[model samples]
Target: MFSTSNTLLYADKLTDFNMPMPHIYACHLSDQLIQFTGPDKKSYLHGQITQDVNLLTNDALLWAGQCDAKGKLWSILRLFNFQDDYFAITSKDEIENALAEFKKYAVFAKVDIEQNKNHQLVGLFGDDLSAVLSELEIILPTENNSTIDFKFGKAIKLDNNRLILCIDKKAQLPSCITLLESEQKWQSLSILAGEPKLNNQAIAEYVPQMVNLQAIGGISFKKGCYKGQETVARMKFLGKNKRAMYILEANTNKPFEATEVEQQLGENWRRAGKLIQTSFDIDTNRAYALAIMPNDLALDTLLRTKQENPISIEIKPLPYSLIEE
Candidate 1:
């Protein structure tokens, strides 16, 4: 059985169970929340992120990106509106750097940007989520990108089977809720779901389009100017984006790390792209990763690692079509 005390420690032992139900799993995300309070919060964010902050409703969540002047992404954010105050979640490791960048423009705005450590991010996956929530008399939003208030915290519906619970650090969950502490399992599900989460290593590396942010409703070309508006707009209108995100699977003796992934042309390997994130299942010896690579590459193209004994990678289809609308 999996215990919350040590989540990843028992991952390899999952196969020993007779038939594991689609257990409700939880993991504390390496995601940090930034609180933006003051009358100018919404207006200030509108000019900084890729998504239109003005369109964010109290019941809906927005997945947005903060990019550099050149259109390269600084960090991907999940913005929430609570009680007239706006809160956004970004990579915990990169929050300090993101805050510094925001400070440059916030000087003129009348908003306060500060990290809120009072809350913790918990990710829940599996078909049992709805039933589990129902037992607590907590109802989740039926629509994707929508949110509802729960007793333990705020639940953001990612899909019918997945949710992201932003809980208060002091609140305790019911004993009926089973927690899965393994970051690997949580990450594997995210990669397989075609969700792109940026980390410290990925900051200021690629633009939103390279990671298919536009396809996931993370970018709004119709919105007013933001930091990278021109660059992002040109790529969308002029068809200038040459790279896109793709999912790949491979077998590794250990686990796959976030490194530069390469592609084979003939006998030589060239730099194809960099990995955004990766997950591994030790029981199956299967590793999954999300990588940004040239969009024009042939479907039969083969990918490998930069190591001397390169591990072969197989291409996998994304959950949604990549066609830009």
Candidate 2:
């Protein structure tokens, strides 16, 4: 069920066949992986993300953003050091577009931007991840706050809600596979992580804060202005007013289309928000979805899908702080 080429590497690790299935998948990027070199490298990225790049040790993984002049997040990233080179991984949805955008700005900068889909990324999840790794005698990365180049398995908190064991695809290890979580679990977990994806439905609908990007270390207030900085800063200091994304859980059998309207709001069946991702509990058959809703909406807001088995949903608190400032 897995394929490898001369340019690729693959390994499987022990995992529980029962609890939260482990999934191994590559992080495909349309935008080339930009390797920044030279003395100006740190300053360049420090100007980009929410966290101070200068503060990041070689082993630190920083959560950052590439935003528009108005501060709308064009892309989200996690950057770390790899030897003398610095690597950044962004979302697949915006990779190509982001790459094109960066090329225009690169101008005379000393950076090498090349599509590095050649370097596959394999991830392991579940409460048993550490146990399985130990069984294989693999030395997992230490849980140090410092930034270190990772060679094999290392558990990092993607956010407050989920922990991930990240492995470089090119590394050799015991049999380890990526167990793709069901659509519902994946979405629910993502929402809990407070990490938002730029899907077709959520592509340009909201700004960075609407998805709580800055609150999760995705934006840097001290950094020089990149694209969309003004808007993001204004919203943070002034207020978001009435717009923000919310996560809710409800029950229904109706089929739901993310970003599409499925319920009546007022005058007509207006668009409330988009169903960004979803996963179902294999045992309960209950679907949990992640969605973007108006900030004023209630947690128990009623929602229905258009399918014959209309799906129901409920709002839940994201496992992060959503501060006004």
Taken over the whole model, the C-alpha lDDT of each candidate is 0.78, 0.54
Q: For each predicted model, how many residue pairs clash, with residues at least 3 apart or on different chains? A: 0, 49
Candidate 1, 1-325: lDDT as tens digits = 2224434443334441123535665667777889898889889999999998877888888889899999988888888887678888887666877788777878798999998887888777665675668755678767887888767667888877677877778766554456655666667767877888776688888889888899888998888888988888888899999999888888777677548788887898899988878888776677888888898877678888666667888888888878976
Q: Least lDDT summed over 10 consecutive residues: which range in candidate 1?
A: 10-19
- lDDT of model 2, residue 121: 44
The top-ranked prediction according to TM-score is: 1
lDDT of 2: 0.54
Q: After superposing candidate 2, which stretches have Cα over 4 Å from the reference?
A: 1-39, 135-150, 153-173, 176-188, 250-255, 261-269, 279-284, 306-309
lDDT of 1 at 35: 87
Most lDDT-accurate candidate: 1
All candidates: TM-score: 0.91, 0.75
Candidate 2 similarity to native, TM-score: 0.75
Give each prediction's root-mean-square deviation over alpha carbons: 3.1, 5.6
Model 2 CA lDDT for position 187: 46
